[model samples]
Target: MQHFAQYDGEWQNRAELSCLLDILAISSRMDLRNEITKEIERLTKTLVVFLQNPNVDRNKLEQTIEQLNQLNLTLMSSSGRVDQVLGQVDLLKCLAQRNSIPGGSCDFDLPAYHFWLNKPLAERLQYTQSWTADLTPIKQSISLLLQFIRSSASPNTVIAKSGFYQQSLDSSQPAQLLRVSLERNAAYFAEISGGKHRFSIRFMLPADTERPSQTEQNVHFSLHICQL
Candidate 1:
């Protein structure tokens, strides 16, 4: 639980970037304005912090900054067009509330949404794609940062006797992420927890709505102590 706290920001941003990319691929334009707005703010803050950090790679930082500047220009030029599209996407709030229900997006539930969906597919695709064009820089930057972080450490095979494992870390070399993977046929999942100086993992069997208990047998898994 504690180790997870360390990379929450990075993971959340990564997830948002991924979701945006997927949504951008579709012809239906759900109101992605809020998501895009939030990600733009997050990326700007991240880029500012990166530029201020002297220890970061200068070459990579320069490339990222250049891309961000171009994206800023795009954003400024398309502000009005983007706003018009956002104004027309008024079903987002209702869609959010009923998303979990089966057949939630039926015509009766959101007639305006159905009307938009009835537009020519090509037009829908064009509008949605254009709306996210200015986000290219942030998408690229997030992808690169995640790749760098994951590649910073190599995976090692570890065994948990009776489904419990613990290890002490060298405080000087702090890990930014902890990855635990097991064989496809394995019957248990790993519950990981740790702090800056140590880490622990408990392998527990799958239990639906019931408390999961640790496995009594030894478990084999791959551990990646990612550092960035």
Candidate 2:
């Protein structure tokens, strides 16, 4: 969706086509709908427990739970695999097949796709809307879940001595995600790696034509151990 937003004005409609292919590939591998439903259920249960806590904001908690409930209902109403509707579109199926090969989706290889892309912007957008309508539920669910998870943890200032840092994770409360924030103009970037028990971060200098080496200077950044 971000890509779609970024390239919405262009003639190629690359984002729209790529989005379709991504949805098809993802849905073919697993039951994404079921996994999202289960995650929503789990998060909802966790939020319900917070409602009784005096320190937590009841109004906001209730609102989030309500949103989750609505999203859950929308997801439940969406029948079959998420890509089932997209798979029925012949043009998209052909495009997906040709997209796997280098230079395979050229105008000569897919005249139909070329024709579709050449349609008026309004017509192409309308078709894009219809093709992606069924994916709305899953998209909204993921957006909300991520929003909540990211906000669950507050950022803390931490320093990595000699550009390296390591921390042990609590087994009882494993993190869903780890976020590292640095100054926009900083010369170094963070490389994070981890497993269930621990995580490490290394700040490396950017190199254009050579391997990046870790900076020897201490690096300070904001870290968020997001758990929900």
What is each predicted model's overall lDDT from 0 to 1?
A: 0.63, 0.87
lDDT of 2 by residue, 1-228 (tens): 545634545444866787778877887798877899999999999999998999999998899899999999988888777687656899988888888899888899998888887777778878887888888788899999999899989999999999999999998998999999999999999999999999999999989999999999999999999998
Q: Score candidate 2 by TM-score against the native.
A: 0.93
Instruction: Show how many residue pairs clash in every candidate, following the order shown.
Output: 0, 0
List TM-scores for all candidates, in order: 0.58, 0.93
Full-model lDDT, candidate 2: 0.87
Residue ranges of candidate 1 with Cα displaced over 4 Å: 1-88, 97-104, 118-120
lDDT of 1 by residue, 1-228 (tens): 123222325343233333443444342354333444454455556566777788988788778656655655544444433224334445544544455588776779868656655565456455446555545544554455566568768899988999999999989877768889899899999998999889999999988999999999998899998865
Question: 173 in model 2: Cα distance from truth in Å?
Answer: 0.6
> Which pairs of residues clash in candidate 1, taking residues 3 or more apart in a chain or in different chains?
none
RMSD of each: 10.5, 1.8
